[model samples]
Target: MLKIKNLHASIDDNGVLKSILKGINLEIKAGEVHAIMGPNGSGKSTLASVVAGKEEFEVTKGTVLFNDEDIEDLAAEERAHKGIFLSFQYPVEIPGVSVTNFMKTAINETRKAKGLEEMPAKEMLKLIREKSELLEIDRKFLSRSLNEGFSGGEKKRNEIFQMAMLEPKLAILDETDSGLDIDALRIVANGVNKLKSKDNAVLVITHYQRLLEYIVPDFVHVLLDGRIVKSGGKELAHELEEKGYDWIKEEVNA
Candidate 1:
């Protein structure tokens, strides 16, 4: 449901722009899961941010199309409203906002954007209960402030819970497995797998292949030096795990 072509993005460093993503071309159709595996500073997350419309990165070239429309000019919130959800590597802490309260506001705001009335209190409550239970999130946990004092697993699980509630067409998970324990990873991956459907797509960006053991990707792409130098099937991830990115770099440079 998402297509990116020849995307080049850069971040400004004290008034000078430093290039990050260079010539990234990818297509994620509905009902597929795609993984982006890369080493440090390879612009894996940059592609996710650019597609999510993060303002810090400027897209100097190429186009990002969601479904069939160009969203390169849209703001982050606008892209979110259009069914693009990005799970951050580091989810920010909101001191006083309970998870339940935050979800209520987000859902209603999206509804408002679609010219629909607020969800009835009863329906909203049902949704919260269902999604929390789907992600195995405790109701008591939901009562706590969002991401405040949460363990790495709790934070990542909470992000998946949010994704469950939002039900985006394309879900971009940017290093959700970072710092998560094995059990936590399993839980988060289970939640993501359960949420997968023929109507939605998932893009997982990570440095390790372990996460793929759970939420298996239909395709894997290797990003090197800000460009996707190689694209292959799920087996490619295993190859990368066995042989580091050096071999891919060599192949690309050859």
Candidate 2:
């Protein structure tokens, strides 16, 4: 459902152009889960931001096609309206806005974009209940302001909850496992796994292979130096876990 061809992205640091993603080529089909693993500063997060149409990073070349439509020029909100959802590494805190209220506004805005009326109050409540249960979130927690003073685990789980409600066709989870303990990681991964379907895809960008144990990926890719240097099956993640990124760097240099 998502295709990127020869994509190159750069960012400006005080007027100095610094390249991050140098000629990336990837294709993700529906129902597939792809994991991107790499060392720090390998442009993993940059790729996610570029795909989400973040304006800070400029695409020097290439195209990103979602369902055969070029979305390189589309704004970030436009991309979200087009079924793209990005879960941030650090979820921001919104002091006074309850989770339920935030989600209602988001869903209605998306519906308005599609020329649909607001969802009926009863239906919206039903959806909130169902998705919260799916993510194992407590009803009381939904009313406690979005991400405000939430623990790391709660923030990550709340991200999954938001993803569940949005039902985006493509979900890009950028370091969702960051700062999460083993139990929290398992819960979040379970939610992601349960949410997976034949009509949607997931792109997980992580530094460690441990998260893969819970949410098994169909493909594992090694990204290095602003480009994807290798692509392999799930066992590739195991190899990286055992050998570290040095071997991948050596192989790329070879």
For residues 1-254, could you state the per-residue lDDT of candidate 2 as single tens digits? 99999999999999999999999999999999999999999999999999998899999999999989999878898899999999998899999999999999999999998899999999999999999998889999999999999998899999999999999999999999998999889889998999899999999999999899999999999999988999999999999999999988887899
Model 2 backbone overlap count: 0
Error of 2 at 51 (Å): 1.0
Show model 2 residue runs off by greater than 4 Å. none
Give each model's whole-structure lDDT: 0.94, 0.94
Which regions of candidate 1 fall more than 4 Å away from where they truly are? none
The 10-residue segment with the lowest total lDDT in model 1: 45-54
lDDT of 1 by residue, 95-200 (tens): 9999999999999999999999999999989999999888888899999999999998899999999999999999999999998999889989999999999999
Cα misplacement distance, residue 160 of candidate 2 (Å) = 0.4
